[model samples]
Each structure stands twice: as structure tokens, then as C-alpha cells.
Target: MEKLRIVFMGTPDFAVGILDTIYNSQFEIAAVITAPDKPAGRGQKVSVSAVKTYALEKNLPILQPTNLKNEEFLAELASYNANLQIVVAFRMLPEVVWKMPKLGTFNLHASLLPNYRGAAPINWAIINGETETGVTTFFIDDKIDTGAMILNKKIAIDSNENVGQLHDKLMHLGSETVIETLELIEKGNVTTTIQTENSELKTAYKLNKDNCKIDWTKSGIEIYNQIRGLCPYPAAWTYIKDGENEWNVKIYDSKYIEEAHTYSIGTIISGKKEMKIAVANGFIQIESLQFPGKNKMQIHELLNGTQISSEAFVK
Candidate 1:
């Protein structure tokens, strides 16, 4: 129960909240391990990870290793002499690193373990039309997302909740869980539960460009879920062809019309302030979308400037 020295590993904004919460806690943070700076944006300027920025501001030691198994990096990481290591939104760690900490490394995952176990869990849960999702903290093991569970906290997924909304919710929920986990570890009261392997478990594989493309042949509800699941990041995109003009349009927000429609799927029905695409069940009413080289905007705003005819078909 003595003051525990901890090391944190993460890279994205999702990890930032948890790191900030832990940094403000009573435990001593030995060092932070994050991804190396990479070039980004139009100028291709080097950009630091969110964790690194926050760690620098808090004056915490940082180590960004290009190779996790490198001897020099491993030696430096071992020098921290941390009792526990916490990971959130980070790459898979080698056994040498996760096994080094006395209390072992625990990862903050976006979904409840034993289900939706993979990258992009939040997106897959919604895409599969699940009404519930949760966050879990588990000990790091050799297999991805396959580890003994420490604790989990469930949260309801609204019928129409998008991935972006669910992501922020889980991020904050995970912060609280991480703090509770640290307390459990310090008190020596942690009991790990083996993750039950189910053959029917739905693995959340990382989304790709091809997978995010809207499939108009599906029902309106299915299309609606797909749009929301991929919203605000790697959005659901489709080709819009207007005679000689064919361009890609990414859908960010939409609604489903359950009423039956006779029109063939992918038919674009446009109006002054509203646009809908025909599907097997009915239509997917476009609410917010982005054109190539343009910022996301409402259907009306897009219609006001673009000459998208009702006759134009969506592919």
C-alpha cells in the first residue's frame, strides 16, 4: 500500500484524459511511453502525440521508442522501476514491457471484454446495431484484447447514438475505471477474471476504406447504422454521379425512413433542403455530409451551392 510508482503508455486524445486523471492522483508517475512524432497536415510538419503534449506540460518523463523490443529502450523503461503500467489507445506491447511492471500492465479497452474485442470496438458495436456497450480494464496478454479482466463498467448505447458520441462517453468512463483500478491494485484487492472465449464473439476488426463505403442495397435502417457508426472519422462514403460528374461524398449524419419505396437502391432523391437515398426498405435522409475538398455541412447548405438533381444516382 506504499506510494506506487506508475508508468503510462498511450498515444491519442482518448488516452490524454486518463493520463491527466492519473497524473493528478496521489500515485507517482515515473514516465510516459507514447508514439514518436510524425509529420502531418498540409505543411507536413512534425506532430506530437496528445499524450506527449500533456506529459510535457506536466513535466513527466517521456520515452518514445521506434521499436518496443529494442534493448536500449527496454533498459531505459526498466530503469523507471514502476510497480504498475497502464495502457490506453496504444499499440500492442511486447511481453518484456508489459511483464516488467510488478503489478503487470492493464489496458483500457472501449468495449466490454470477451465481446467486441479488437480495434475499433465502438464503431463495430454500433454498426452491428447493439443497444449496449461498455469499457473494461484487463491485464495485457500475448493475444490482442485477450487478457484477464480486473473491472468493467457498462453504459447504455442510445438507439441513435453515433460513434463520436459513444467514443467521448467511453473515454470519460474509462478515466474513472482506470483510477478505480489503480486503487484496487494498491490495496492488493484485485481479483482477475479469465475472459471466457465464445465462438460467436463478434470481433471488431479495424475499419478500412472499402468497409466504410455505404452499401445502398441494404435496408434503410442498416444504412443508417453504418453511417452513424463511422461518423466524424473515416466516414461512410459513396459515389455520387451526376451525368459526367462523379465524386465521393462522405455521410456524417442521416435518418432512416422506414416506409417502403419502389425506387431502385442508390437512387438520389433531392429537394431544396433535404436529400434522401433509396434503399431496400425506404430511404436514408441525409442530414450532414462532406464533399471532397469541403468541410462537413447540413443538407441544405450543400444543396444551396451544388447542383445535385433529383435524377442524379448514388453509387
Candidate 2:
């Protein structure tokens, strides 16, 4: 079989895994297209995208075009004469770019097609308390994540799995799926299946600041899942009022305790060893948390080092 010339487009760590697999596989990578480096963190130092960093280390040719539709960029992309393009965790592409490759551009999505098709698939799956989620390799079309599927591999979502854990799971699974899809394409035996015909397609819409706020009025399971979904990054937060001062607390990890509770919703409950907050139905014992200006730390450690009066309440 002739080695397919691939142009890989991606930006995040999830994309890096797929790129690494392709790099080590039998396929030929003509070039890598990734987001441009931008300032990040408190120092505001320029930071290269995860995919770009890996590509640079491997000495792969890299393209960082601010606009995918730019004539010059498109012309430069066409110069590579790639047989196909692979997209993972990258911004939406225009028809001009997706249609440029002869074998067509394929995207490696984190969730099963027609569901969680927006931006934060891993987070959304956890938030919705899904029992299973998977990755899909599909053709890139005019619509976002609405393309015909080339391949899909389902994986179970553990009841206690957080976004961080689920992300790693899908990252590895997606890498292998992308490699397999490419192999099938090279053999001229690939088949494309349309997404489900049902109209109730779940969307993984982009997460924003507003949605990250914890609503104590929700059920214990809902609050628990939301906290876990946003943990470690874009953490789910709630405001705590202490007299005249208000503090924003980011919940990093928690567990749902089935024990009965007398406190009303949004009340802070504490024990000798644990700190929990009463939700609508049950209590969520916070294992890890962070203050507005502090780094994430265990509740025990935070309590030992800093004094949190029991009288203080978390709004």
C-alpha cells in the first residue's frame, strides 16, 4: 500500500497523542498545522500549543495560520500535496481547507458522533452523568461534528471518573482510533456511516464562566457531577459569605455522602476530618478545594494551615 501523505491539524494535548501515534506509525506526515503561540499564565510568556510543541520536538514542518481561509495560507497548504488531512481538537475549518485534500479531511472527535459534538465533550459527558462515551473518526463537512463517521470505538465511563481521568482515557483511545482509521483509508476499504437520524442530538457546547458556577439548588448528584466535570481546570466554584467579606471557592474534588442531612441547601457542613456542603438532596464532602488566590490543596491541609471558622457559610 502506498503511504498516505497526511497534514495533521490540532492544538491541545489530546491532539498530541494522535500526532505521536501517526509519527510512530507507517504513515507519512507531510506537515502539521496548529494554533499560533500566545501569552499565557501570570508571567504572560508566549506559550506554544501542545501539538506544536510536540511537532517541533519531532522536527515536523509546522504551519500556524491565523486565518485558515487566507489565500496565501491555503496555497501554502496545497503546496504540500497531502493526500489527506487529520483534525483533532482544532478550530472549525472552512470548506476551502477541508476540501483541499484529495482523500478528504477527517476529524477525531472525543465523543460518539451526533452527541457531545460541540467543544467540551469530556466535560459534558461527565456533567451529564453518562455511563459510556467514545471517540469517533469522521469526515469533515460544512457542519461542525455533523459529518459522516468513518470509525467509532466506545468506552465505558466509570461512575466516579472525573473529567481529568476521562480525558486521559479518551486521549489514548482516540489516538489508536485515528491510526486505525488511517490504515483503513490507505487500504481503500474505508466505509462512512451517517450519524443517527434522531433529532435529539446532544451537544457539547463550549464551557463558559457562567456555567462553571455551582448552583446549590440542584440535586446532590447534579452538583457532584458538575464539580467533577470542571475539576482541575475551569473548576466549578461557589461564593462563600463571611460577614461582610465574600470568598470564591473552587471545588476540585468531592464525594457524595448518602447520610441524612439536617442543613438546608447551600449550607456548609464540617466534621473533624472532612468539610462538606449540603445540597438539595445530600451532602458533598469536599476532598480538595482552592481559594480565590491560592493553589488547589487538600481540605485537611488547608484547614491545618489556615483557620476556617465553622460559623462561616458557603453561599
How much does each candidate deviate from the true structure in C-alpha RMSD? 1.0, 1.2
Question: Candidate 1 overall Cα lDDT vs. reference?
Answer: 0.92
Residue-by-residue lDDT tens digits, candidate 1, 1-315: 756899999998999999988988887899999999999999999999999999999999999999999999999999999989999999999999899988899999999888998889999999999999999999999989999999999999998889999999998999999999999999999999999986899999999999999888877788899999998887999999998899898999999988776887888899888898888888899999988999999999988988787679998
lDDT of each: 0.92, 0.90
Candidate 1 to native Cα RMSD, angstroms: 1.0
Q: Find the 10 residues in a row with the least total lDDT in model 2.
A: 306-315
lDDT of 1 at 159: 84
Best by TM-score: 1
Model 1: ten consecutive residues of lowest lDDT: 214-223
lDDT (0-100) at residue 53 of candidate 2?
Answer: 92
RMSD of 2: 1.2
lDDT of 2 by residue, 1-315 (tens): 656999999998989988999999988999999999899999999999999999989999999999999999999999999989999999999999999988999999999988999999999999999999999999999989999999999999998988989999998999899989998999988999998857787889899988999888888899889999997788999898756778888898999976677787777766556788887677889999998888888998887876656666776
lDDT, candidate 2, at 211: 90
Q: TM-scores of all models? A: 0.98, 0.97
